[model samples]
Target: MIRIENLRKTYGKIQALCGIDLHVPAGELFAYLGPNGAGKTTSIRILTGLTRLSAGAAALNGHDIAAQSTAAKRQCGLVPQHVNLDSELTVGENLDLHGRLFGMPAATRRQRIAELLAYVELGDRVHSLVKQLSGGLKRRVMIARALLHNPRILFLDEPTVGLDPAIRRRIWSLIKQIQQQGTTIFLTTHYIEEAEFLADRVAFLDSGRIVAVDSPTALMAGVGHWAVDWVSDAGLQSAYFPSREAAQAAGAARHNGFTLRRVNLEDAFLTLTGKKVATDANAQTVHGQGHGAHAAATRNPTGGQAKKGH
Candidate 1:
């Protein structure tokens, strides 16, 4: 479980988080939705102790994040937005190293490695070097490493970023399995549908502040059931309606590029924040659109996988 109250963070003149307050119950999958600089990663960093908060209180499970840093950290696992697995190491080697860092016993590490490799369906890649594996496989390895300690909560910041749709779904299924196993999951993603499909509740944040939080269905319903999109003087414009007949009526009177579709979580986010989710693909056109590289950086400037761990 995770809880926050009046969470605020600042970097000199820039305010990254402003009075954020939220709660995620145990075994629930909570998605944090926002565009770039919307405080998604900043909030994740603060929760994971990678970045400190300026003023606020946060707790992981039952431990105070500030006053009980070690215990709080031990309560959660983080899979960063970018891939951080060492390319030179084999899949098994990468996981083994993570276990060692957690001070896991040799026998325990071996058992956990075997179990997780099968859980992620990467058993055959046990000896395969990380560089030789596909992007999807590498991501599975990241999840395995993050779960090595079997923490009570998981923090996934853009977990499916940069992957193709098919591979992204595989990761989504894995995340769902983890949640079914009773791990609290806190996820941040630019892919609007990903949140809708995977999250039990969604929160929209803008300019470092939380604007709305609710189930994806409730949020979408708040706007309307249908959306009519068409070209306007201001370029692309969309209108929301409570019924398909209303949207169809509007579409009949519109010019080219008119489309009548069900309103989505993206519509809810756009209504609340006036900004679109990060993606070259239109989030409104389909139900399962992924953002690819428009979602998150695949690697650091060094052209290598960056490091992320406890």
Candidate 2:
């Protein structure tokens, strides 16, 4: 339901996005994955009509984003990365207000809010103040508010970022439920496992360009048939062939303890980007941007819940 052709975005001297071409089919969950400074959010913002593109064309449900932004955006719901709800308003009130903003009538708004709160598993907390909700609950509230308009497409940016495992699984199940009901979900996330678990197709972005795009299985297969491993500092090496026939043909070249295991999306991501996974929990500095307020400000817009809609 989303088509982006040669999309580019630049900020003065820095080219944040360099000609991204992506296509997300209707009712599919497509995940855009990248590490820090790889332009995942830049692409998402353009798709959501929040950020203007420098060059190329993009469309949602065949409506051009630049020429028909209103119509295009009306067909999509966005759950931003940061909290954007009114702290003073009750959860139901917040959703009700958003429904009205979308021009939904009071009766429909009430019904939709009820359904959304239930879908996000926040039915009991509907009467509570948004400020009093847990982070996960607030995130669900943000999602409920976004769905108040019943957009055909949904844009989720790191929807499971900081939640604990239990809450994260709940959110994941909710996303799956939405997708099953025919909502085309386009999401950007740093979590490779999330993409592997949830995405119908996955795209890897690096240095403002799409390095690889395919099904998780197809992308991993494209990496290669040989699985090579080298032990750290010990010079221990191994190579496993895909089949026994192939291994026998190589004779002495084959080694034991090397099973034919398929590579995953993470392997594909690292191979394509040449960057190690950011494993340090406190390692905040990213792409030369320090781990301070400046970095936080300039970080990918998908870092947290920032705004509601365009």
Candidate 3:
């Protein structure tokens, strides 16, 4: 339901997008995975008519974003990174206000607000002020407000960035439910696990261009090698091969028996970008704000900015 071709955006000397080309099929949950400044937000802004493109074109539900700005926006819902709701407003009031802003009929707004509150599990707290809610609750309220108009496509920017593990999983399940009902979801997130679970297809961006776009399984397979590890007399010897069978063959040639384990998205990420991230639990974290992976000079169409992190 969305198409972008050679979409370019420049802010004076800073080029946020470098002629990106992408397509999202109707009802697909597509994830844009990248570091902070990789132009994920820039792309979303342009698609939502918040930012103008310097060149190329983008359309939502077959309507050009630039030429038919209002129509394009009407078909889309956005949950931005920052919370923008009035803290003093009650949950119900906030949703009601947004529904009114969208010009939804009173009867329709009432029904949708009820459905949205229940969907977000905030039905019991409809009368609670936004300022009185917890971090997770506030986030849910934001989501409900976005759904007030029931747009065809939903764009979420770092939806679960600061939530705890439990709340994050809850939101993940909620997103899946939304997708099951046939809403096209375009999401940007720092959690690789979230992308693995939610995205039907993922586009990994670096330095304003897509390095790879495919199903998660296909992307993992393209990286090559199973990445098994075992402590032996050699002390952490690493090997690379064309496939798991080859890696196993090399292992057999060197050792009697070794434990083999499957690799994950983190391994694929490391192979693609060649940088190791540090998470709190000793496991690798996703990229931080402004961490640029290797940029292919050939991929940039405009080459407008020197380099800036999102």
Candidate 4:
């Protein structure tokens, strides 16, 4: 239940979002992916009412985000890249405060707190301090807090960024559960596997422009079904093959450090933009800017200051 038309965001000479247009039907999980500085966070801030748009229009559940800001915000919940919860507050209290911000009544807030804590499997941590919880647990609390007001859509920005694979998988299951219960999910992730496994449709954003949008399978297949890579004198390069046999042949042609695996969303992005999405494991720089897989260009829409961090 989201619609956008020519959404644009500009900060001084930089155009963060260049006329983006999209539609997300109710209950669909859409993944937005891009290299650093592609304006993913800028779009999210505008959608969540944290920042105003420079131009164009967006509607959430039929409410205009710019014209009807409050109603539009009520239809969406956001889980940011970095954990923003109060460290000193107990898990329940943090959720309670969020509910209160939405003007939820005491009785309704209480019931939602218990149900959401249970929903995120954090019932025992209800009285525990947020700082005392592990990274995974803290992220779960964030999800629970975001859902406390029962928004129609959930905006998850790198939900499992630094978690261990096991904990990340658990959070994946939780996200799927929420989607099954009919909450439209807008996910941005550096982990290609996460989007491949979780999203119904995926969009690739590059240089403030949408390069491609399709189902994961469709995108992957567009490039090919398999990928073979090897270290060469020039540098690392990859080739896409349509079948296991072709990939094997390509691998056999290689004499060193040859690796063959199924094609994934990363390959699709590389094929489309000639750029790699960043992540926490290793930092890669384009020009002089660091775009870790999870780093967002948190530039002020109206100003030139862009603070980017992991």
Task: Provide the TM-score for each candidate, comma-separated.
Answer: 0.90, 0.81, 0.81, 0.88
Candidate 1 residue lDDT tens string, 104-148: 899999999999999999988899989998888888999999999
Candidate 1 Cα misplacement greater than 4 A, ranges: 255-257, 282-310
Clashes per model (N, Cα, C within 3 A): 0, 6, 3, 3
In model 4, state the lDDT of residue 62.
97
Q: Rank the candidates by TM-score, best first.
A: 1, 4, 3, 2
Which structure is stronger by lDDT: 1 or 2?
Answer: 1
Clashing pairs in 2: 81-304, 81-305, 82-304, 82-305, 82-306, 83-305
Clashing pairs in 1: none
For each candidate, the alpha-carbon lDDT, in order, equals 0.84, 0.75, 0.76, 0.83
Q: What is the lDDT of residue 100 in candidate 2?
A: 80
- lDDT string, candidate 2, 229-299, tens digits: 32323332334456535633443343322222234565577677766334333123222222122111222
Q: Give the per-residue Cα lDDT of candidate 2 at 251.
A: 35
Q: In model 4, which range of ten residues has the least summed lDDT? A: 282-291
Model 4 residue 277 CA deviation in Å: 1.5
Selected candidate, larger TM-score, 2 vs 3: 3
User: If both were scored by lDDT, which would come out higher, candidate 2 or candidate 3?
Assistant: 3
Number of residue pairs clashing in candidate 1, backbone atoms closer than 3 angstroms, sequence gap of 3 or more or interchain: 0
